[model samples]
Target: KTRQKGKKKKKNINLNQSKKQSVSFVCLTCHEKEEIPLSVVRDFDLMDDGDPTTPPMFSCEKCGGRMYPEYYEGVHGIKYRLSDIL
Candidate 1:
């Protein structure tokens, strides 16, 4: 009997893939949410900026720590990173 040829391995879309799109974000610094283009934001979030495997940590202008989105709000107010859009 003849042996079958080696089969090709399928590529995993999830494991290795970087989407190239003009991602937009908003930086809630002062009193307004600044619209950030992907080109601008990518510069700040570059691999060289932080640990290659982890996201960069930045300080917040409003409160402290990181500031992005305010998905959570209670008796006080929505707490999120103003940098979330960044």
Candidate 2:
């Protein structure tokens, strides 16, 4: 992994709207959820700001599958599912 040093900028992702400081990552294949700090996520551009259909930046450690963010809506209390497009 390449390490870059500087101030980490925050994106417009809805994680800020929540009280929790961290977000959850779900493995596409294994269905395992891992709650990771937002600082770790800021290291890379996981979600494409230009396109919501873009894939995530990281891969699963256990199964080598793709890892995507699990976005939760606080108002209606719903989780948005990341769809896979072939």
Q: What are the C-alpha RMSDs, in order, of all predicted structures?
A: 12.5, 12.5
Give model 1's TM-score versus the native structure. 0.29
Q: Whole-model lDDT for model 2 versus the true structure? A: 0.56
Summarize candidate 1's per-residue lDDT along 4-78 as a digit string, tens digits: 222212233432333332332233344423233445444555544434333333345454444332222211232
- Worst 10-residue lDDT window, candidate 2: 1-10
Which 10 consecutive residues of model 1 have the lowest summed lDDT? 1-10
CA lDDT, candidate 1, residue 41: 45
User: Candidate 1 at residue 11, lDDT?
Assistant: 36
Clashing residue pairs, backbone N/CA/C < 3 A, model 1:
26-85, 67-81, 67-82, 67-83, 68-81, 68-82, 68-84, 69-80
Q: How much is the lDDT of residue 71 in candidate 2?
A: 61
For candidate 1, give the lDDT. 0.36
What local lDDT score does residue 31 receive in model 1, on the 0 to 100 scale?
Answer: 40
